[model samples]
Target: MSFDLTKAETPKADDAETETAPEESAARRGGLVDFLSGPAGRNLGLVLALVLLIIVGILTGGERFASTDNALTILRLGSVIGVVSVGMTFVIAGEGIDLSVGAIVALCSVWATTIATQTMAADYHWSVMVFVALAVGAGCGLVNGVLIAYGRIAPFIATLAMLAAARGLAEIIAKRRTQIIRERGFVDFFGGSVAGVPVLVIMFAAVAAAGWVLLNRTTFGRRTLAIGGNPEAARLAGIRVQRHTMYLYILLGLACGIAAVMLMARTTTGTSTHGTLYELDAIAAVVIGGTLLSGGRATLVGTVLGVLIFTTLTNVFTLNNLDTSTQAVAKGAIIVAAVLLQQRVARTGST
Candidate 1:
């Protein structure tokens, strides 16, 4: 009887262990699910995609694609568009869009390189030209914000109008000619490198860092997310939806200004044609970076990676002698695929 009791108790202990094993497994599964649902989880896919593209480029293009010079070139080229993409991220996250960022860059660059600003640079400080570019960009963004937020106009139409207007203004200012940057210090410093890093690359890093802080660490960022997630709800929550919307546009405009400076420094010329089709590039990068197009989500790191991916792709294409038209086709396909993937993810998450 004693032996029988001990055997029965041993079976009970085994049963308890079996039950606890499932519980422990479920706990780990829950943790993994939570992680996959988080932002980092979302970005992981994009990072892997980027890594795959790099591998493909290396395999296809050989040493040229993997060279340090090409790598620097990709970064330098990507920085300008990357900055613009950062601004676009905010705009899209706030349930809004801007079709005029490229045009704004053109306008800002042209304005900064105008005779008046250049004359100021010659007489006073080269920094004055930098200020002018930022001012023009901020002003353009302010107009877009006011129209969308207060005027109750749609973002698409408002920014479309701005696209035409800003480009037109740039053309008029530059008289349909390229405005060469002749300010020696402006050319040397911005076009030069610091500790072997391109100034453009440095500027991109600074802007990305600042944007991450603004979108993650500040009240403004939270409000922006609230508004984008649900405007009516945000209004009920005591957030000034309209004003905040306007602020978002202004922030984007400021980014364009900074990008204008970078473009001017890199190319040494500002033209109405400078940022042509850049709007599409910025939008593509933002979307690919895992930022939801329906708003309420933003990822600066994702956008940076998106920029790098696009830039690297372009570099790979160029190295392989792919035509511009072919690149356009590929880019369009990517945009559609990304949108579809997002939809699928959203559906899965909802379930």
Candidate 2:
């Protein structure tokens, strides 16, 4: 038909290339959005926050803050709390709260350090103390789980009652005195390190790694997320919401027990005062780590970063000689800001 063969020969202006340019651009934008809205994105923000804190520490604390010793101190300070935060993460992810974590830590520490427990450790092995601490922690967690899961008690009330009861019990056991750890083996085991890292820090790392795997790579984690996201939906899907929920609390209890041991090692004493206000610290760390207070989502990495950030902040404040009142005020401000930012990010992602 004497068509424009010249035009056809000219490759039709390469419309495909031009068309794909827009598509490619759109794809790039989508990739960026996904990264920012996903765990990577959340962790990126935390990393940025930590970097900012580091910068602040440097500026305020000068060489003192920049020293290796200071850095180790920060990590050491964060280690115990970080372990507890990991457990707190699981509990929150399961759509539950644990106000008794601090009390449980106190109770575990006191119980493990009791005259009888210590006597057994002195007679046999320090593992006895470790076992008792873990048992106490698990027992407390079981009680909380039973009340919340089977007894149909509210998490807040149940844990609050535990808070009072546990703390009181610890006080009664310790008789308002600090119980010094006499088992040298227990202290050395948890207090020692591998390859220059503090044992406390190492334990924290191990727990965090295990927690990450548990939450992201296992069936149990999926079930926890399902329950937290929607208990009804998860149940409809055949997930055991009640039993799983109990497991979550018990998980937290074990964490508290570990934390108790760490604290006992660090301070060489177990007192009712041990873990005072720890619930607040652990909850704050978990929340700031990008875990949804209402459940459904959690980030163990973010929680670790949150713990570090707080530890660094405290270090910075201490280095700068800031008063506790000022530090408290600053913490409150950070918490408010983090929650606000989290809400904004959530909305942006949804849209």
Where does candidate 2 have its weakest 10-residue lDDT segment? 7-16
Q: Write the per-residue lDDT of candidate 1 for residues 1-351, one digit (tens) a residue.
A: 346776665667678899899999978866766566567886897789889989989998999998888899999999999999999999999999999999999999999998888999999999999999999999999999999999999999999999999999999999999988889899998999998889899999999999999999999899988888999999999999999999999999999999999999998998899888999999999998888888998889989989998998898899999999999998899889988978876765565
| Cα RMSD of predicted structure 2 | 3.3
Best by lDDT: 2
Cα lDDT listed for each candidate: 0.92, 0.93
TM-score result, candidate 2: 0.91
For candidate 2, write residues 1-351 as lDDT tens digits. 579877776754477789789999988877887787688988988899899999989998899999998998999999999999999999999899999999999999999999999999999999999999999999999999999999999999999999999999999999999999989999999889888889999889999999999999999999998899999999999998999999999999999999999999999999999998899899999988989988999999999999998999999999998998998898889888888877877786676
